[model samples]
Target: MSQSLQAAAQRLERWIKEDAIPLWLERGIDTETGVNIERLDVTGAVDREADIRVRVQARQAFFFAQAYDRGWCPQGKDVAQKMLQFVQQHAAHPTAGGGYTHLMNPHYEVIDSKQDLYDHAFFLLANAWSYRAFGDAAALAEADRLIAHLDKKFGAANGGWLEGDYAYACRRQNPHMHLFEAFLALYDATGNAKYLARTAELFALFQTRFFDESNGLLFEFFNDDWTRLADARGSWVEPGHMMEWVWLLDWYSRRSGRPVQAYLDALYARGLAIGQAPSGLLYDVVAENGDVVDTGKRCWGITELIKASLVQIRSGHPQAEAIAIKAVDDLFTYYLSASTAGSYVDRRGADDEVIVDVAPASTLYHLIVVAVELLDHCEGRVQAR
Candidate 1:
């Protein structure tokens, strides 16, 4: 690694371990409920009255578990256990068969009991991470129960699961993408071939239902039959999702001995071509025809880019190391706050103005993932040098 990149990695490690993780644990947790607070203002005040989404709860749990795994936070296991207990207590549908509820009020009352694929996927992820972090048998059993419930309730005839009960004419690929992520984590935690088999099935669905061979972009919405929608939603593409898939596909290949170079190359090229802004940050949304639909840049998108770049660099992609360095530089320059110590500006408009003033607790997961990956990358590069 270049001396500059090595220095950048060190800075990121300090920020995550010393600033971000501690800040979140202190201000982002709801002490009364033992659940995660939804957001923190620029001044680091918690949003106490905000409606807590189950996915956010799960993501925060996953973050702390990951932080513990990376040795960045000593109290990560305790935080994760608290968060997981809270989720199990309040997030489950009270009268419904077995899936998690969508949202809960500050007082831990279920506000929305609608079964959502996205929420279930994150619930599974939270369980997997909790099991891995603390050897919680209940967490693993809950993961299995959630998987069975998802298959029973939301299973689609075409292969992938349905979005939810409120599904319109189009089904989204986002939930399935997350399920793929959750299954991979489950397989890693339990050494279960069933999870691996399920992941492979989702990958096949990505090729058949999600990926657009015509333009190399992944479509966001599909019809009831898994065909791409003909309208604007069908043409919508997210660069973040492409980069995320690139990272996952690479991981899958390494673990399963699957050949995914073609998909990876196409996704990487298309992501850069359509998703990248002049600022070197990823645009929020683009049309399949390469028009910028939403000119917003989000913190999560940049994190996905960092992850994909690191994966590519490990694979010896010629330009990946430079791309990863530039991404790290941008992350520090625009997203990381100068005065807030640990908080970040979550969204910026196309003109580079701050769109959201408050930092989201959910974003901590993305930031921690990038920091962990960069730490390993930098260490490997130093040893190689």
Candidate 2:
């Protein structure tokens, strides 16, 4: 590694360990409910009135669990346990037979009781990490139960799980992508053949349904029968997701002994060609034809791009290290805050103005994962798959 990239990686490690994790652990939690607060204002004040999403809770749990595994935070395991308990107590539907509720008010009251596939994906992910962190068999058991519930309730006949009642109009590849991620985590945690099988199944679905072989892009929305949507509805694509799939496909290949170099090459090329704005930062959304849809940029997308770059570097892409370094620099320059040590501006408009002032708790997962990946690469822990 170059001296500059090494220094940047070290700086990100310090920021994540000393600033971000501590800030979130100190100020981002709701003491009354033992759940993470949804957001923190630029001044670092908790937004108590924000509606808590189940996905955020699960994300926080996953974050702390990973933190605990890395020895970054001493209380990470305890915090993960508290957050998981909160989910089990408050997020589960009272009368519904399966799946967790979608949203809750600040007071821990159920605001939306509908089951969402995205939310459940995170729930399973959290459990998988919790079990890995603390060796808690109950967490794995809960994950199994939730997986059973998902199969029973959200399973679609065509392939993949449905998006539930939330958006019955069209199916989404985003949720299935996440479920693919969760299944991978579960397989890692337990060496369960079933979870590995599910990962393979989701990968097949991605090849057939989500991935657009014509343009080398991944479509965001799909029809009920897993057909790509037409026109604007189907044309909308997120470069961040394409980048994310690059990372996931690489990981899947490493774990499953599957060869996905062709897929990675196509995704990386397409993401670089159509995913970036004029500024070189990854754009939020674009059409399949490469028209800019939403010029707004988000922190999560940038982090995913960094991850994809790192994966490419590990895979021996010639220019990938330079790309990864540039991504790290962009992340620090645009999204990360100067005054607020750990906080970030979540979104920026096309004009470079801040669209969202509050720092979302959900973004911690993205930041943490990027930092860890960079650190691993710099420290020679990442071996080429």
Off by over 4 Å in 1: 167-169, 381-385
Kindly report which residue pairs in candidate 2 clash with one another.
none
For model 1 the TM-score comes to 0.96
> Any idea what lDDT model 2 has?
0.87
In each prediction, how many residue pairs overlap at the backbone (N, C-alpha, C within less than 3 A)?
A: 0, 0
Q: Each prediction's Cα lDDT score?
A: 0.85, 0.87
Q: Top model by lDDT, which number?
A: 2
Candidate 2 Cα misplacement greater than 4 A, ranges: none
Q: TM-score per candidate, in order?
A: 0.96, 0.97
